[model samples]
Target chain A: MKKINFYILLFVALLSVLGAGCINEQTEDVASNGESGENEVTGTETQIDTIYQFSVIDALLEGVYDGEITCGELKENGDFGLGTFDNLDGEMLELDGVIYQVKADGNVYEVQDTETSPFAAVTFFETDIQDSIKTEMNSQELAAFIEDMLPSQNLMYAVKVTGNFSYMKTRSVAAQEKPYPRLVDVTKDQSVFEFNDTEGTIVGYWMPEFVNGINVPGYHLHFITTDRTAGGHILDYTISSGTIEIDSCDSFYLELPENENYQSTGLSADNEADLEEAEN
Target chain B: MKKINFYILLFVALLSVLGAGCINEQTEDVASNGESGENEVTGTETQIDTIYQFSVIDALLEGVYDGEITCGELKENGDFGLGTFDNLDGEMLELDGVIYQVKADGNVYEVQDTETSPFAAVTFFETDIQDSIKTEMNSQELAAFIEDMLPSQNLMYAVKVTGNFSYMKTRSVAAQEKPYPRLVDVTKDQSVFEFNDTEGTIVGYWMPEFVNGINVPGYHLHFITTDRTAGGHILDYTISSGTIEIDSCDSFYLELPENENYQSTGLSADNEADLEEAEN
Candidate 1:
């Protein structure tokens, strides 16, 4: 009876040791993930998903970013989509009636079943980083680059010719409506650039220029707006217009152009008559 | 007595007619002003001490702009001081220990002290068309123009190495302690690009092969920032440094070089560590 008991105890002890060892091995195996696990690595596992956050030094340093976004959740086979400035591309990516294509970079993956959460993004940069944060850019580093890239008025010119001349000019507004757009140059005609539906308020000038390698002076008119659009499209808003005029020297000839909507007022150049009326 | 009285009356009537003509000329001149007394053909007066507000826009139509400020009095032939971001001969121009350069092609004026208010600050492209409501860019246009001139990131890559190989990779943070600095690739230990302390940020990247005519990898670095310069200095604070590491089989080993400041941390082969930490 004693010998039998010893054998049973020994057998139980051996099984317990094996069980503990197996559990440790399983934990270590799971922890050894190339991207998310806690295990130590033995070889290169570049084909994996990782998460990284970037640090932004300046609060005012915000603008458009160019990158990619994957599925909302993790899945096998590494299927995902991509996003660029005005468009998204991938395998059957259709958002709001717009189709997108994939980036073909092989580092993106897709999430299954969930629709509200769009995509799960990833990167392989040795230092884990996200598109918004890990741009491989620092504050000072970005500022320097921006300084060099700044647009200056040095490449443009301003000219004025008044006192009885009817020459042509061009007005060029941005493809999208941008508020406080740079007023480059204006036309020689009496046309005015109007703002949003605010009648009798001319805010810009109409200048002409060439298009498609052809000199189409005054063919294209431009105005400045504070609106934007990815694909160039005109907005459904009211606009003000300005016109040119020539007045006689004797009359109080204010060059207020005639407008069908806004009545044009006339003035006489008679100085004494105007002064007498003011005094009375 | 009757004949003399008749002659006097005729003389008085003729004098009145001539005076009326002169008065009419003055009245016409004022009317030609388009009821905009401040709208002179020369230029709008801008106050040097005035403050302007600004903002950024980045939809399809992207821009930055300054809002509004009172125009300062103008002086003829003023000896105005140099402004910021002014370029001299394609390089940033320096005057009185200040860099002054504008990107647009327009007339540059030196403020003179002869007039009542010779001092003047800058405005942006104008679009307002309400008579003398000249669309000289309020603050918004100026802000947008400056913002547009900044640089952007085109491409980025992640770097990783496997095994226990030791190597050295050194590059220059050329815009040290500057507002927005640029990074340059250095093969041989030599400063290919000079530094600008006042601008104190990495402004651009000087590729080794293209800039120095050397056969090297496209080890190009691009950096950009939007933080404005304060008191003519580039940087407002310091940023932390980065680290380097290597990948083993299923585990990642932190690699630390002798006397190196970077902190090397271990990463898993599947990136499971990073994933879990993010959730927490």
Candidate 2:
């Protein structure tokens, strides 16, 4: 009976030691994770390439539509991208390191680096894949063709299509004053412009579906003429011939606005329907 | 005629000099911005706090249900957040510096730091605001109340609700095998659990609408008991009394999966409807 008791005591002591060891290890893990600054300072730089986003779609939908980031700062992030100026001033197209504003009057203006945007997504263009289109294709057909050629559906792609278009249809909205209306409302008064046999480039992103609320899903393209005289948000286009360059992005970064209007807006409403209406 | 010609020449020279000056400034700006690594290295460490996200809802909806980040890495980013394991194994609730897996067997297991998750949103808990709720409220009412009390809708908020609840309803999905079904389909087989007059804490986030596609808009809460034995994704709750702590985030970083499955998934569908169905 004494031997049995001693054996039981030994088992209990072993269990306690193991339990304590587990607890100690967990405590150390938590302590290390919680020490943010020290670890980051000591750790090697993260070499991840990331796509930078300014503001968010929900704030735009709720009428918090004033620019927070300047064109100068935006350019610091990427050389190619699309967005609108403050108060939905006009469609912005950044191509070949130059920023152009396509106004509702159907004329393009060279935007100063000092100008600001309420929303934008930009990336330094580095071509991962390049291909040429031999056959004529419209916007829908072009999207379909690209869809078939995509290496993967899960990754975000930045696409640049440069060529002469048989016909191009685009639209631009006038800038609004303070107390801006929602993006959908602002887009309602957009002016449509058409070009015949225009040589230009389309700058846009093929966003993954998972980024729906945060960004426009699928192909979002903007156009600018080669001469930098005309451009707008691309609605439709007939590509006579073109070369497509795609950049696959594996990292993403989002910067939110700090203004009071952005902070106070009611953002709980389901805005997908509205977003589709405005974007399409 | 000679005098006039000389004046024109002088004017042209002046114009050329000014143009050269502008071009030089722009060239410098582009050069500085294009060199990402050198600029980041030289620039002061950005003191801005940020929330990090992995994968996205749309990817999961399209059946891209595989773990890409280990629990060890996730904890390295933040100690407080919620997500699911590989193949929708169980509900993941990381609270108070410990990661817990509430399995379908209705048991809480301390997840190893080495386990991986397909999706997650985590931010170190550093409370910016703390307030006590004096009134009784249901889940909807509590959400509404919290909305009214928020400092800003544009900023992301990590919220913690701790107190005794009149009732708490939660759900957890069983672990899935390879060739997983859509999230909606997987959710159809979820197991729901309820607790009466229980004391526990809710860990979750209040995301802006602009991030709809990237994350769940509004409140997303996961629960764990005080004893750390019972918990899951919070479906509803009646809070008798609780203290709410919120941490406002101004920056966000999203880490994409490096796996091939994440690389090849088609993410072009409008997934707001599907996301709403899966989340709510």
Note the DockQ of each predicted structure. 0.01, 0.29
Q: Candidate 1 docking: what grade?
A: incorrect
The most accurate candidate by TM-score is 2
Candidate 2 chain A, poorest ten consecutive residues by summed lDDT: A39-48
Candidate 2 C-alpha lDDT tens digits along B20-63? 55433432332222112121111111211467789876777777
Place model 2 in a CAPRI quality band: acceptable
Whole-model lDDT values for every prediction: 0.18, 0.74
How far is B154's C-alpha from truth in model 2 (Å)?
Answer: 4.0
Stretches off by above 4 angstroms in model 2 are A1-49, A188-191, A266-280, B1-49, B61-63, B188-193, B196-198, B263-280
- Candidate 1 vs. truth: CA RMSD? 36.5
Q: A132-194 in candidate 2: lDDT tens per residue?
A: 988889989989777665556666788888898999999999989877788899889999999
TM-score of chain B of each: 0.14, 0.82
